[model samples]
Target: MMLSLFDQFMSPTFLGVPLIVLALTLPWLLFPIPSNRWLNNRFLTLQTWFIYRFVRQLFLPMHRSGHKWAVLLTSLMLFLITLNMLGLLPYSFTPTTQLSLNLGLAAPLWLATVLIGVRGQLVYSLAHLVPEGTPTLLIPVLVIIETISLLIRPLALGVRLTANLTAGHLLIQLISTATFVLVTTMPLVSFFTATLLVLLTILEIAVAMIQAYVFVLLLSLYLQENV
Candidate 1:
């Protein structure tokens, strides 16, 4: 189905936002959260934590890059991920499932890859990508495949997130949409959305965790290839 850009009239100053950035900021800034954070279940790796902290430090200089942009961008990611898990509640939207939002998330990551990818000698970077010790004959073929795959990383990032989020939302949306229709006709079906919401909520939490892992892993992989 062709997804609609339902809110063409709205201006999202930060990213493909459903609401204004500052509007949501005060609450999170004011409220406290667990320091070890994931609205979803994930494998907690010290490696991932260090890498994330390192990347955040790397971006510190970019504070000149517009504070609003930084805050908005970061918050956009949080909102998406939070909402993805929010199906844990009945009738909440999955913002990431929406193309506008996923595109926003993917674009900056793609740009970051390109910027870093070309920072060093392109030829040297390309050479390192192939790794060490390969069959001489197979090396050329492997290089060709890796080159294509590397070029498509951004597209993969976008498609991966969009597909996963969309599939889950679509499934849950049907359940939700059905609940409303069924409720009018039958009392038994009235409780259906409730039960489905509970089950889907757990699944949604899993999806949220997986998507975050996929996003970060691919992001790290891109940087690893370049640096």
Candidate 2:
């Protein structure tokens, strides 16, 4: 039986239980746990260096208070990158492609940052909705627009991640199918398409890592404003 292109996006089940749970949890186990030893192995050393640089750069713009989110945000970055990269493998599910999952991750964190802003600096938070020296006639309209923009942040985050991953996966699948079909009838053309597929796969790998970074980076920026 032939399957649809999007069938790959559907959640798989075993014994009537969703495998999405395993997809989400398994990536955590893939990461190497830090040990108590003073000296680290090469892989662990590289991992530590990369994470240190990432966190240092990520929180560079924020206040000291925002640094509190380092562990949460860094862990989230790793989780996302792992899921995205793993999803690119054969016969694997990409949970982040689901808007619901993405929104579930985005909304609470976005709201928490907003709440922190409101709690710590209520006047400043409200002031963000209306910039200084606004015309009296435009104040109400500007406030409304800003309010809508503020509320749309989480939705935007979710949609951006879903759209990017979905598009990349679809494009890769379409090209791969084309290459397979052409290989028998048009060897030369299929060769070129196969080469293109390889390049696209490489590009998709980069996209997976980058989209994960951009996701956490935006969250940090939002937190920066509030903190």
Candidate closest to the true structure, highest lDDT: 2
lDDT of 2 by residue, 1-227 (tens): 43898888888999999999999999989888999999989999999999999999999889999999999999999999999999999989999999999999999999999999999999989999999999999999999999999999999999999999999999999999999999999999999999999999999999999999999999999999999
Which 10-residue window in model 2 sums to the lowest lDDT?
1-10
TM-scores for the candidates: 0.56, 0.98
RMSD of 1: 8.9
Where does candidate 1 clash, by residue pair?
none
lDDT of each: 0.59, 0.95
Q: Give a tens-digit lDDT track for model 1, residues 1-227.
A: 42543332233454655454443343355323335555423433553464467457534544333222444444444555555565345424344555565567777876775676577557767675576888888888989898787667677777788787666666766676688888878869769676986798678778886786567555655555555
Q: After superposition, how far is residue 148 of candidate 1 from its true place, in Å?
A: 2.2
Instruction: Report model 2's TM-score to 2 decimal places.
Output: 0.98
Lowest summed lDDT across 10 adjacent residues in model 1 is found at 2-11
Error of 1 at 198 (Å): 1.8
